[model samples]
Each structure stands twice: as C-alpha cells, then as structure tokens.
Target chain A: MKGSANRRVLPGYGLSLGYTIFYLCVIVLIPLAGIFIKTAGMGWADFWHTIWNARVIAAYKVSFLTALAAAGINAVFGLLVAWVLVRYKFPGKSFIDSLVDLPFALPTAVAGVSLTALYAQNGWIGSKLEPLGIKVAYTPLGITIALVFIGLPFVVRTVQPVLQDLEKDTEEAAVMLGAYRFRTFRKIVLPEIAPALLTGFALAFARGIGEYGSVVFISGNMPMKTEIAPLLIMTKLEQYEYAGATAIALVMLVISFIALLIINLLQARMNKRTISA
Target chain B: MAGAVTAHLSEEASVRPQHINESVLVRIVLITIALAFLTLVVIFPLLTVFIEGLKKGWDVYTASLRDADALSALKLTLIVSLIAVPLNTFFGIMAAWAITKFKFRGRNVLITLIDLPFAVSPVISGLIFVLMFGAQGFYGPWLDDHNIQIIFALPGIVLATVFVTFPFVARELIPLMESQGVQEEEAAVVLGAKGLKLFWLVTLPNIKWGLLYGIILCNARAMGEFGAVSVVSGHIRGETNTLPLHIEILYNEYQFSASFAVSSLLVLLAVLTLAVKKFVEWRGSKWQSK
Candidate 1:
C-alpha cells in the first residue's frame, strides 16, 4: 500500500514506514496493552467491585467534575487570552504570550509545591481570599486551580494560530449586516474557531483527569473529599495493592478513552459542518 | 471602517467609544480576575521563595546556593540532562523524520501513539516504568541476576524522563517540518547530495533552527521533570536526587533559604529558555517567509 502511494510522496517509503511502526509498537502499544493484560486477571466481579467501592466512587466524582470545571474554565479564559494575543498589540503582550507555556515547561512537582505555597493559609493571595471565606488551598477548588494552570496553555496554544488565521472580513461583514456584537460573534466568529476551541477543551479535560503532580500538594488528600483518582492510584501503589491500583487505572483509561473518542467525533463533525457551511 | 480598524491595530486599540464605559467596567473586572488568577496560580507562591530567601541578607542567600546537596543535585540534573537530552533529541529527530517524511501502514495510528505520552499523566509514566523495570516488574529478576540496577536509581530517572519528554522534541519538530516544504531538500538532492551529505547539505540547513528550538524546549522539560522522577526514584538524597526533588527535600526539611535558592536556579533556567525562544522566533520570521 505504501509502495503504491510512494509515487505520490517522498522516496524511501519502506525505511521510514518500518521505523514508525516499530517505534510505536515499542513505545506505546506494548506498555498500554500490558496494562490491559495486567487488569484482565481481576475477573469481572473483582473489577466491578474494585472500581465501584465507596472511596473509588467518591474519587471518581471529584476527579471527573473538577477536571470538567477546570477544562471549562480554560476553554473560556484560554480563548480570551488567545484572542487578546492575536487581535491586540498591547505592551508586554509577547511576555504574557510566552508566559503561557510556563506551566507546560515547569516541573509538575515545582508547580505543586508552588501552588500550595501561594494558596496555603498565610500565603499572599490565600490570606487575602481567606477572609472572604473562600479556601483556595488544600481543597477541591485548589485541585481545579492547578488543573486550570496546566490546562491553560493547551487551550491557548491550540486556539491561537486558528484565531490568528481567521479572516477579519467575515467578522466585519457580520457586524455590518446588523448583527449585534454578541450575534456577530455567535454566528460568524465562533463557528469558525469552535473546532479548535473544542480540541483545546478536550485536550485539557483529558489532561486534567489524569493529572497528579500539580494537584498532589494542593488536594490535602483527605479521603472522600479531595482525593483524586490518580492520587488514589498512587496511594494504592504505595500500599502495595498493585492489582487494585491497576484496576482503578483501568477504569479511568476505559472511561477517558470513551469520552475522548466522543469528543474527537464531535470535533470532526464540527469541522465538517464548518466546511459545508 | 476596515482602515480605521487597521489603524487601531497599530495603536493598541481600547474598547471603542460606543463600548467605552461598559468595557472599562468590563476591563477592570477582567483585569482583576486575570491578575488575581495569576497571583494565586503563579506569581505569589513563586515570589514567596524569593522574598523569603532575601529576608536574610545577600550573604546568606549566596551561602545557600553553595550547599553541597544543592550543588550535587544541580550537577546530577546537568549530567542526566546532558546525556538524556541529546539522546532524546536524536530519537525525536528520527521519530519526526519517520513521521513527516513518509506515509506507511498505520500512519495515523502511529501519530496517535506518539501522542500517547502527552495524554498519559506523568504519574502514570512513572508507574509504567516501575511496573516495567522495578524489582517486582517483568524484567526485574533478569536485570537483578545480571547485577544491573535500574529502578530507584539514575537509570530509572533517565528512562522515565526519556519517556515523559519523548514527545516534546518530536511534537515541536513535526509541525514545523510539515509547514516547511520539501522543495529545499529536493533541491539538495537535485544537486546530487545523498544520505548524510543530503541531510547536512540540504535538509539540515533548513530544519536546523527548528531542531534547535525543539531540543531547547525538550531540555527545559527534561531538566525540570519531577512527578515521574519522584515515583521511580527512591530519593536517595545525594545519589538519585535531581534538582526539583532536591528542592522538595530541602523544603520538607524546612531548609527554606536553601530550597528557595535552588528553586530560583530552576526558575532562572526557565527564564533563559523563554528568552531564547524570543530570540529564536526573531530569527525564525525570515525563514518562515520561505
């Protein structure tokens, strides 16, 4: 098959193709498949029991909901940041734009420790917000905050180039045709960029769901309260409950895979609609 | 008018006069939220260490930087990164080359697989290695019989890092390579260059800056890797500890200034990367135009 398509593309079809497949097999498929096999030994009853326990169920809720909330936050603010960077030329714009990737490049442990310090009692803004009866540290909110932190750059970076290349004339025409600002945005601008935005959201959501390093310090790890799924998995591993840990991880993997698949399908549908319209 | 909008673009346009009052209100609200979010998420906590470090004087701050564990951790970081980064760079470049320069069986699947590390959490990355290489893992007994140590050691840290940071260089390289056409490389081939000579004389020149940019980003992430390292590494103080782990140890033991001092060093590296990115972008514009 590649040999046939080789006429259309580059030479050396065999070498690069072989290398790509071999590399993927080694790096990704082997380990992930190993995980599936590892969990296969639990049998149906144990698998269900392991994933549905009181602690596990509670962790599922906190982890999933906080990740959703964080992804939602990133989707909105990320779009705003990307829009600002693309449409405006303010002082320090470049600095802020570059600053977006700080989370991406920064070590997660450092981020975890730093976030804890900043939001803990007696810390700078934590102290200020504490009087308002809002606890930002060692709470579910802190988990969401860290999620938003690491997830922001995904949305920004994913959406920015699309925003940049989006034609201004289309928006101008919408405004001239008696569309209100919000209407112009709703009908014209949003449709064009919605796919990228959704991609950003999905990426962040998947990422937030699996996150550990940034949330560990901030979560307070109180069982039935702030304990996240990944942390719970780590806790299980720490306790030498390897099967139970992998079982929980298998639950996350299956659910995340299904959810992300739906998102990708939605993204593809959106892209198709955009192309047709 | 379109002209007016273009002129406004030059002027860093504020909300137009029609939206002025409302947007000023909106702007204030937005800025407050953005600044507050930044404060809570990034600025304040990061600033705390610096302020706390300086609370004592410059002399103590200087003294803190010279601590043996701190220096050794830094040395280990440089050592591991110095080897690990270049090796990963080679992997990333070859991987990227395989990705972009060919279309083969399961190409889309391969692309998705390459992206697996990014989607998988750092914690999982660590655990996978522990599952693969630890004493209880598959290869564990064999490795032990061979008198080879992998886990809870430097090799484990590097392997975990290579796995975690594997995608970065490839991720950066692929997009740039895709956007960049094969015309130049074809031109080099047309000029009778082959193999390494072709890559060196033709392709490498075009993608050199791109490859460099990816390597630098990869290096930064590899240098600061923590979550995965924390898992596999037993944190043997001076032995398996990297800088970030070292900082965590210091902070845990209440060595505030020393911890801050070491963390500040990591921050400096990050700042340097950010600065280099600026320079790289400045240099890239002309090439991008090609």
Candidate 2:
C-alpha cells in the first residue's frame, strides 16, 4: 500500500521501534536527564566547591589510583590467563576457563564480604601475611584486590577471541627465519592483539573506577584513606546532601561516559581495520 | 643400513623448529602462575563464603536463614526480580528487534545509551531514581500529594534494579540477532506467515537461547544487586531489606555467621547462574555449528 521506496518487507517496525524508544526514554533517558537537570540548578561556585572539596578530591584519587592499579594487575594476569588458555591444553582447562567468570556471576556483596574475610588480619590469608607486617584488608591494596576480582574477566574475555583468530602463519614464518620465540611473539603477536589489549585495559579501568559493592566492605570507608568515589556518593546521599551527591555523580557519570565512548570508537576502528586487512 | 637410518632421523629431529613454542619449563611456569593467581584471587574467596557461613555449624547456618527477617528479605528479592527481569526482558526483545532487524540512524548511539547503566556506578543508578522521586525531587511534592512512595520503597527498588540491568538482555541479543540476519524472517513473511505467527515460529526459536542467556544474567544481578538497591531500600529491616541488603545488615550487626549464611545463598545462586550460563553457551554454539 505504501510507496516502494519506503516499503519494508517485514512488519512490526513501528510497533517495536516505538516501544524501544518509549522504554528507553522513561527507564533510562529521563532518569539520567534528571542528574543533569539537578546539577544544572546548582550555580558554578557551589558546583565547583562541592566536587572540588578535599575529601571528594581524596576520594577521586583513591578511586582512580586503586582502579588503575587493579586494571594494571588484571592486564598482566588476564593476558597470562588468556595466553595460556589459547596456547596450551591441560587438565581441567574448561573448568578453569569457566572460573574466570566467577566474579561476574558472583554477587558483588558476596565477593566483598568473602574477600574481606580472606584478607582480614585474623582471616585465612591475612593471618599468614600478618607475620610479614603486610595488611591487606581495610587498605587501598584491599580495594585494588576487590577491583581486580571484578575486572579480571574483562581483559581475558576481550583478548581471548582476538587471540583465537590470530593467524599462526606469521609466527611460523618468523620462527622459520630464525627469530627467537620471545622476539617473534613481541614483534608479530603483540602488534596484532595490541588494540584488543588496550580495549580490555580501558574496559577494566572503566569498571574499576565505577565499582561499588565489592570495594565498600574491603575499603572500610575510612574517609580520606580508604573511601572510594562511589561510597562518597552514598555517604552524601545518606546525609541528605542531594546536591552534592548529584554533582559527584555527575562527574563520575561524565568520566565513565567519555571512557566508554572512546572504547567504542576504538573498537569500531579496530573492527574496520580488521575487515580491511 | 639400520644404523644409517637412525643417524639420519636423529639429525632431522635436531634440525626441527623447536624455537616456535615455549620451553616446557616456561609453559609449566606460566601455567603455574595463572593457576596460583586464580586460586588465591578467585577460588579461595569463593570457598571462604561457605566455610565461614558454616563455621558456627549447620544449626546456626539453618537458623540464620530461617530468621523471619531473612525470609522476608528473600521474598523481597524474589519479588523485585520477578518484576524487573520480565520488564527488562520485554524491553530487551523489543529493542533488539528494532536495532537489528531494521536499518536506522543513530543505532550506535542507541546501543551506547542502553549500555550507559553498565558504565555508571550502581550507587548512581539508585541515586538517579532518588533524584527523580525523592522527597526533594522534581515530582516529590506531587508523589507526596498522591500518597505515593517511589523512593525508599518497592517502586524505587524495582526502578533501580531495572536501570542497573537495562542493558543485559539487549546486549546479549543485539549481536546475536545482528549475526543471524533478517533472511529467515523475510522468508517466513513471504510464505504468508504474519506478525505474531512469524515471531513465534521463526524469530522466537532463533533468539530464545540468547534471550534466556540475557535473562539469566539479568536475574542474577537483579537478585544480587546491592549498591543501587541499597540506596533506595532505606534498610527498613524486614520491610525494605532485600537479601543482599539483609546480608549487609547482619554483617554490620557483627552477626558474622548469620551474614555469611545469608551470603551463602547468593553464592549458591551465583554458582547456579554460572552452570546455566555454561549450558546456554554450549547449546548456542551447538546450534550455530549446525
């Protein structure tokens, strides 16, 4: 009945698309807009003063640094795990593969409490390490451990597929030419997977910065010391500092959005390059 | 002649490309490090939950779980997941159909917005709802006039859960649907199938595994969600406390055994989630290979 130019073969486009937009607007878009609108109502000085306070700045530092440390740790171990899983065959390999996703499947609260118990001075691992004057629980180190638990799968999962699809011909050629194993890997394999690694690092970093439930129990919420950015928002909310919470949330939201945007752009570029190459 | 053949074989073996792979020692070392790290970081903590939960023995474990407040929190968690999972599932299916089945502008932007919640802090996820419906929120006065409660109540809990889980189902289905393409659906349509028939017969079967996979993830998060639900829950004991929040309550009360006992239930759920996820993935891959 309609013009052929605009005609569609299948139906429900309007019904489905309309529902999608409406739901997106109500459930996500409008609520997020509330954050911006609430912050916009705060004047410039108040806004600056709220987010720029010493405590908030300290929280930002802890959050960023711990998340960075956690992401860094995950990048190393995650790469190792991904490399092993792809390159080797061993006993219980599939089981170990599934275990990498435990953090994602496990509740954050459970992870937080369990990690705390494991790391507390009197707890299992903590007791052993206590003799060496190492305290993990209730410290930034504990926070990094929790974030590592949460962000571990991101790096492995992201890099696993890329590694799987990597062509072995180049590596074989390099070895045939007498290149050493390490040198061949460093030159051939690393470049092929660098984008994926960077994407995983960015993903893990973004997740670490925004992490909440897992970090809280281990963090001990020691204000300037152990408190994370998300916990600060929770504290402000509890104290009925709606404007302050809004401002902090706004800042976090923006940073996370920008990080996600960059990752998406990077992935798109990688996908295009992969298709072309 | 036999001695000469043996010497030739030995020489060829010596000239083989043994440098391509890591030495046996190196492989063993790398695997050992990966396993040791996973043991300390993942497996130990997972085991700790159960061990600590039962430290006070089975009697205490069962007694803590049978506590009235614990049961209520469990009920609330189920209720919230019941409402939130299906709603998000419906939204997920619709959004995936739209984004994948048709060519449209701003598709990438739409996908990112759906994923927005993942990048946002869970605390902020809850705070967003509070800002919209709290006592000082934009519609605060209106909700008050109607004797309505969104923040610090059931509605607020559900909203936060929904927001936190908004992307799970859609994220699973979009790539799946995109990869499957529209050829099958078009063929069904051309053969006189229409609307619901087309979907039920064609689309549903194709996407069911993915949809179920999404629901599994969404349900796990919905039930286990703490930070977002914590913000709006108000921690009203047996009234507003979900299971995760209840665990926090018991933990704060220094009822260490009781808290871990409650946590063990979610641990069980998490284990179950992983098991089912493995199944779905297996089935999906099998189907794809067909």
lDDT of 1 by residue, A132-216 (tens): 9999888999999989987887787777766666665676676667777667767877888888888888888888898887788
Candidate 2 per-residue C-alpha lDDT over A48-135 given as tens digits, one digit per residue, 9 for 90 to 100: 9999989999999999999999999998999999888877767887788778878887889999999999999999999999999999
lDDT of 2 at A250: 95
Give the winner by TM-score. Answer: 2
- Classify candidate 2 by CAPRI docking class: medium
- Poorest 10 consecutive residues by lDDT, candidate 2 chain A: A1-10
Q: Which ten residues in a row have the lowest lDDT in candidate 1 chain B?
A: B1-10
Off by over 4 Å in 2: A1-7, B1-19
User: Candidate 1 on B1-290: residue-level lDDT in tens?
Assistant: 00000000122233333421124455455555655555555666567667766767888788878877777888888888887788667766777767666554666566666766776667677777777778877788999999988889888888788777776677767766766656666656557766667666666777777677678878888899887788888888778899988878887787767777777787777777766666667667765456
Against the correct fold, how does model 1 do in TM-score?
A: 0.89
lDDT of 2 by residue, B195-279 (tens): 8899899999988877887898889999999999999989998899999999888888899999999999999888887777777
Tell me what TM-score chain A of model 1 achieves.
Answer: 0.92
